[model samples]
Target chain A: MSLIQEVSSFLTHEADLLDQGNFEAWLELYEDDALYWVPSSPEQTDMKGQVSIMLEDVPLLKLRVRRLSHPRAYAVTPKPATIHLIGNINASEEDSLVMVSSKLIMTQVRDNVATSLSGAVTHHLKRSEGGFGIKLKRVDLIEAGGTFSAISVPL
Target chain B: MLTIDEINNIAGVDGMQARAYTDPDIFELEMDQIFRRAWIFIGHDSQVPNSGDFIRTRMGVDEILLVRQPDSSLRVLSNNCTHRGTRLCAVAQGNTKSFVCPYHAWGFALDGVLKAVPDIESYPGSFDIKDKALHLISAARVESYRGFIFASKATAGPNLYDFLGRMTEAIDNLLDRSPDGEIVMEGGHFSVRYHGNWKLHHENANDTVHPGYVHESSVTSARQAEGGVTPQDELVDRGQTKGMMASNGLTAKDWNAIELNGLPQGHSFMGGFYKSGLLAPQQSDAAIETYREALEASHGKEKAAKILGMDRFNNLVWPNLNVNAQFHQIRVVYPVAVNETIIKGYCFRLKGAPDEIFYRAVRFLGTLVSPASMIFSDDLEIFGRVQAGLETGSLDRLDSRRGIKTDQKNGNALQSTTSSELPLRTQSKAWRHWMSPDT
Candidate 1:
C-alpha cells in the first residue's frame, strides 16, 4: 500500500479495536510516552494547568482499560457499545514522524439511549518496529463548552 | 403539590421520602426556600480581579452577574434588564464596561447603573431615566471568606460566618495551605450534567462508603496493576467491595484513619487523611518540596506543617458548594429540574506558589473529578441508577441511619466514625430547616 494508504489503514484498525472493546490490543498501540488528551474546551492547549476531558499517560490509560474490563464496573457493566466512523483522513510525514488528522463520529449506546459524539481527532505518530505507535492523540469535541452526561467510554 | 406537612415530614435522623428526589413541586419550592435563602457561592474574587471584569453565574434559578466595579469592589447584580426583563449579559464571562440588552438595546454600566436607552424620546413622559436605571437587584447579603464569595437572596438571616459555623475552618485550612494566604481561580471549568437530584451530588461529596463499591473496578484495576494479588473475581464481588476509600492508591487502613465531621447548618467535612500521604502521590517530589518551602517561609515550619498536613477532603458549604481543599477546587451544583443537575468544577491556583504546585492541583482535578475520570464515572453511573430507581416508587425511604447511634454531638458539630452517615443526616436537618414554611 502507499504511505497515505498505510497510515489510513492503521487509523482504521485502531478505531476497530476500540469499537470492538479489544482494549488490550488498543493499549499496545501507544508509545510509552504517548499522551491521550481530549480537551474540555475548544481551543485548550495547556494540559498542566488546565482541565481537560481526558489527559492520560500510559499508566492512566491502562487503568482506564482495566476499569472498563472489570466485571463490577457498574459504569461499564451494561457497557455503552460504541461505533467509531472515522473519515476525512489527512496525513503528513517528516523525519520518520507522521501527523494524521481525521473527523470522527462516535455513537455510543446504553440502555436504549444513544449519544452521538462528533469530534476532530489528531494523532502524532512515530514509526516503530511494528508499523507505527501513537505519540499523542488529541480529540477535540464539537460540543466543547456544552454540558455533558457521563462520558464513561473513551472517545 | 407537596403540602407543608409533607415538606415537614422530611427527617434527617431517619430516612427521607423518595418524593424529595422525584417531585417537581418540591423542587420548585426548594428553589425558593433553600437556594434563594441560603448563602450560595457566586464566584471567587480572583475571577474578576480588575475593573470591568465580569463573570455570569446562577443563584438557584435566577441569573447573576458578578462584576468588578471601577472602585475595586465586587457587585453581584441581577442579569435581568430593567426594561422588558431581558437578560443583560449573554456571555458566560468577559471584560466589558457595560452590558446591553439584545432585545431593545437597553444598556447598563459595569456596576449596573443605567447607561443608555437608544430611543428615550419614543417613550411616554412616565419614562423617568432615574427610575428606569437598570433595576439593580443586588443579592441581599454578599460576603467573602478568604476570597470565596457567597450571596444570599433573603433580606435577613444569619451572616455568612454563622451559616458557615465550623465549616469555616475547612476553608481556612484551604487558604492557609497557600503561602500567600490566597488562591487564584485558574484552569478552565469542567461542567457535567447528570440525570440525578442535586442532593445526591451534595450527599456524595462527604460520602465515605459509596466510593469503594462504586469505584471498585478502577480501584481494583489500579491495585492489580501495582502487583497486588486481589483476585479478579474477588475484586468484582459486590459484598467485598470497599468503595472509594479503598480505591486508587488509598488502602482500607488509610480510609479508617479518616474522620468525618458533621457540622451545623448542613455543612460537613471528612478529615484525618491529609497526613497519610494520599495527596503526596498526586504531586511530584520537586513540586511538593517547593510548595513546602514556600509554606514554611510564610508561616514558619511548625504552623506550615499543620496547615499542609490538614486531612480535610470534601467540605460542603450547605446548599450548593463543595470545597475539596486538598485538590484546590470548588464544585458548584446547579439543579435544573427534579432529575437534572449541572456540576461545574473550578480549580484554583495558589498565589505565590510555584507553577508546578498549581499544575499538580489541576492534574488531580482532571484525573479524579473531571467527567473523564474513571473514578467519577462510577459515581455518575450510581447517580443515574438512583434517579431511575426512585421513579419506580419501590423504595419509599432512602436510608441515612448508619453510625447514628455512635454519633457524638460537640456544641453544634456532630462527630462520628470515618464511614458514618452523619453528613447526610446533618444535610437533611438543614434541608428540613430551610424548606420549612417558617424559616
Candidate 2:
C-alpha cells in the first residue's frame, strides 16, 4: 500500500480497537509521548494555558483505563458501551509528514440511556516504517455550546 | 385567605409542593415575590473586572447585565433596552463601549444611561434622552461581600448582611481559605441540569445523611480504592452493604449522635464529619497562618481558629446560594422549571495558595460530584426518579419526616441530628418567608 493508504488503515484500525473495548491494544497505536486532548473551550489550543475536558498523558490514560475496566468504578458499573464511527479520512503530506482529519460519532450507552456525540477529530501523524502512530489527537464537539456531562473517556 | 398563602403554607413543612414544581401560578408568584425581593446572586465581581466588561447573567430567567462601570463599581442593570425593550447584550461576556439595541438603534452607556436614540430630529426637540424615565432600570439593591455580588429588586428590606445573617461566617471561611485573604471565581464554571425541584439540590448540599446512603456506591468505591481501614471497609466487614455508606460508616445509633445547627434568617449549617478538612495539606498551613494573621488584623487569633477549623460548615445564604465552606466552592441553583433546576459549580482561587490546594478542590468535584461520578450521579438519578414519580399525581405531600420533633427550636431556626430533615425544613422556612406577601 502507499504511505497514505497504510496510515489511513492504521487510523481506522485504531478506532476499531477502541469501539471494541480493547483499550490495551488501542494504547499501542500511540507513540510513547502521544497526547489526547478534549479542550474545555473552543479557543483552547495549549493544555498548559487552559484546562481540558480530557488531558491525558500515557500514565493518566493508563489510570483512567484501569478505573474504567474495574468493576468497582461505580460510575461505570454497567460500563459505557460505545461505538465509534470514524470517517472522512484525509491525509496530506506537509514536509513529508502525514496530517489527518476525520469526523467521529461516538454513541455511548449507560444504564439504558444512549447519547450520540458528533465531533471533528484531528490527528497529527508521523510516518514510521510499520505505519503511522498518532502524536496528538484533538476532538472538538459539535455541541460546544451545550453543557457536557462528566467526560471520562478519550473521544 | 388567598390560595397563594395556603400554597406557601403547605410548602412550609413538605419542602416544595407539587404545584410549585409544575404549576404556572406558583411560578409567576415566585417570579415576583421570591426572585424580585430576595438578594439573589448575579455573578462574581471577578466575572467583570474592568470598565465596559459585562456578563449577561440571569435572576430567575430575568436576564440582567452585570457590568463594571467607569467609576470601578459593578452595576446590575436590566438587559432590556430603554427604547423598545430589546435585550441589550447578546453575548455571554465581553468588553463593550456601549450597548446599542439592535431593534431601535437606541444606545445606552455601560452604566445603563440612555445615551442617544436614532433620528434625534424626529422628536420635535421636546424629548430628553437623559431623563430618568429613559434610563434602564437598575436592580433595586446591589451589594458585594468579599467579591461576590448579590442583587435584589425590593427597595426596602434587611441589608444583605441581615439577610445572610449567620451564613456570613461560611462565606468568611471560604474567603479565608486563600492565603492572601481573598478568593475569586477561577477555573471558570461548570453548569448542569437536574430534572428535579431546585430545592432538592439546595437541600442536598447539607444533607450529610444521604451521602452514606444515596452515594454509598461512591463512598464504598472511594474507600476501597484508598486501600485502608475505611468507614467503607468496616461496613463491608460487617456484611452491611445496604446501610454502609448511608450510616456514614457509623452504626445506626451513631447516626443519631451528630448535630445539625439551624441558624437565624432561615440559614442552616450541617455539623457532622468534622474529621475531613477540605483544603489540601500543603495549602492548609499557609492558609491557616495567613487567616490567623488576617483575623488578628481584623478581629483576633482565637476568633480566627474558631473560624477556620470550626467544624465542617455547609451553609445556605437565604434563597438561592449555598456556600460549602469545607469544600471551598459554591453551588448556585437557578430554578428553570419547578421540576427542573440548573446548578452551576464554581471553584475559587485562594490568591496566594499552592496549586495543590486548587487541585484538591478540583479533585473534590471530580471524584464526588462530577456528572462522571457515580457518587453524585446516584443521587442525581434518585432525584430524577423522584421528580418523574411526583408527576404521577398520586400524592399530595412529600415527607421531611426524619428528625422533626427532636429539633432544638431557637425561634425562626432549629437544630437536629445529622440524619435529620432540618436542612430541608430550614430551606422551606426561608422559602415560605420569601414567597410570602410581606416579602
Candidate 3:
C-alpha cells in the first residue's frame, strides 16, 4: 500500500477497534507521550489556559479506558455502541511525524437512544519499528459550542 | 393551571410531589414567581471588560444583552429591538459599538441609546428620534457582589445583599482565596443540557451521598489502579494493578467529617474536605510556593492560611447558582421546560496568581464537571433517569427527610450532618415561599 493508503488503513482499523469496544487494542495505537484532545470551542487554542471538552494525557486516557471497561460504569452500563464513518482522509509527511486529517461521523446508541456526532479528526503519528503510534489526536466537533449531553465515550 | 392549594400541595417540609418535575403548568408558575422575581446571576464582570463589549444571556426565558458602558459599568437591556421587535444581537459575545437591527437598519448604542436610523425623512412628523431610542427594559435591580453580577426583575424585594444573607460569606470566602482579593472568568465555559428538571441540578450540588454510589465505577477503577482492592473487585476479578489512580482521595472518615450547613434564603453548602489550606492538589510545587507567597504578601500568613483553609463545596445560592470555592468555578442552572434543563459552568482565574494556579483550576473544571468528565456523566445519567422515572408516576413523593431529626437550629442557619437531606428540605421550603403569591 502507498503511504497515504497505509495511513488511511491505520485510522480505519483504529475506528474498528473503538466501535467493537476493544479499548485495550485501540489504546495500543498511542505512544507513551500521546495527547488526546477535543477542543470545547472552535477558537480554542491554549489547552492549559482554556478548558477543553477533553485534554487527556496518557495516564488520564488510561484511567478513562479503565473506567469504561469496568462493569459498574453507570454512565455506560448498557454501553454506547458506536459506528465511526471516516472519510476525506489525507496525509502528509513532515520530518519524523506523519500528519493525517479526516472527517468523522459517529453514531452512538445507548438505552434505545441514538446520537449522531460529526467532527474533524486530526492525528500526528510517529513511525515505529512495529507500526505507527499516535502522538497527538485532536477531535473538533461541529456542535462544540452548543449544549451537549454527557459525552460518555471518546469521539 | 395549578391552583394555590395545588401548588402548596406539591412541596412541604417532608418532600415534594413528583408532578413538580413533570407538570408544564407548574414550571410556568415557577418561571413567573421564582425565576422572574428572584435575583438571578447573569454573568461575571470580566466577561465584558472593554467598553462596548457585550454578551448575550438569558434571565429565565427572556433573552438579555449585558453591555459594558463607556464608564465601565454594565447595562442589562432586553435583547429585542425596539423597532419592529427583531432580535438585536445574535452573537453570543462580541465587541461592538452599536447594534443595528437587521430588518429596519435601526441602530442602538451600547448603552441602549437609539443612535442612527436609515432614511430619517421617510417617517411622518412626530417621530422623535430621541424618544425612539431602544426601549430599554432595565432589570428592576442590578448589583454586583465582588465581580459576580446578579439582576432581579421584581421592582420591590429585598436588596441583593439582604437576599444573599449568609450566602455572602461563601462568596467572600471564594474571592478571598485570591491573593489580590479578586477573580476573573478566564476559561470559556462548558454547557450541558440534561433531560431533567432544573431543580435536580441545584439539589445535586449539595448531595454528599450520591458521589459514593453514582460514581462507583470511577471510584472502583481508581482504587483498583492504585493497587487497592475495591469492594467491586470481588464481583469482577480484573487482575494486574499498580498505576496512577484517579480518585478524589476522600476517605470514609473524611466523608463523615463533612458538615452540611443550611443557610437562609434557600442557600446551603458542604464543608470539611479541604481543611488543610489547599484547593485540590496544586499543579506543581513551584506553583504552590508562588501562590502561597503571593497570598502571604497580600494578607498576613496567618490570615491567608485561614482563608485558604476554608473548606467549602457546592455553595448553592437558591433557584440557580452553584459556586465551588475549591475550584473557583460557578455553575448556573436554567430551566427550559418541566423535563429539560441547561447548565453552564464557568471557571475563574485568581488575579495575580501563578499561571499554574489557573491551569489547575481549568483542569479541575474539565475533569470534575464538564460533560466529558466521567464523574459528571454519571450524575447526568441519574438525572435523566430520575426525570423519566418521575414521569411514570410510580412514586408520588420524592423524599428529602434524611437527617431532619439531627438538625440543630443555630440562628437563621440550620446545621446538619454531612450526608443530611437538610439542604434539599431547606431548598423546598424556600421554593414554597417564593412560589406563593403572598410572599
Identify the leading candidate in terms of lDDT.
3
Candidate 2, residues B102-156, lDDT tens digits: the string is 9988888888889888898788666998788788888878998778789988898
Candidate 1 Cα lDDT to native? 0.80
- Candidate 2 regions exceeding 4 Å error are A1-37, A43-51, A55-83, A90-101, A107-116, A122-138, A142-146, A149-154, B1-5, B12-15, B123-133, B224-258, B276-308, B365-374, B410-412
Deviating ranges (above 4 Å) for candidate 3:
B1-4, B113-134, B226-253, B275-284
**DockQ agreement of candidate 3 with the native complex:** 0.49
List, residue by residue over A1-155, the lDDT tens digit for candidate 2.
Answer: 77567766877788788877888778777766677666555656544323345555554455455555655444456667888888887777788567888889988887687877788888888767767777778888775545655443556
Candidate number that wins on lDDT, 1 or 3:
3
Give the winner by DockQ: 1 or 3: 1
Predicted complex 2: DockQ: 0.17
Candidates sorted on TM-score, descending: 1, 3, 2
Checking candidate 2 for backbone clashes, the offending pairs are B212-B245, B212-B246, B213-B246
Q: For residue B389, give model 1's deviation from the true position in Å.
A: 0.6
Candidate 3 residue B232 C-alpha distance from true site, Å: 31
- Candidate 3 on B50-168: residue-level lDDT in tens? 99999999988788998888998888888898878889889999999888889988888777778788999998787877883445666767788887889888989889898888778
TM-score of each: 0.92, 0.80, 0.92
Candidate ordering by DockQ (highest first)? 1, 3, 2
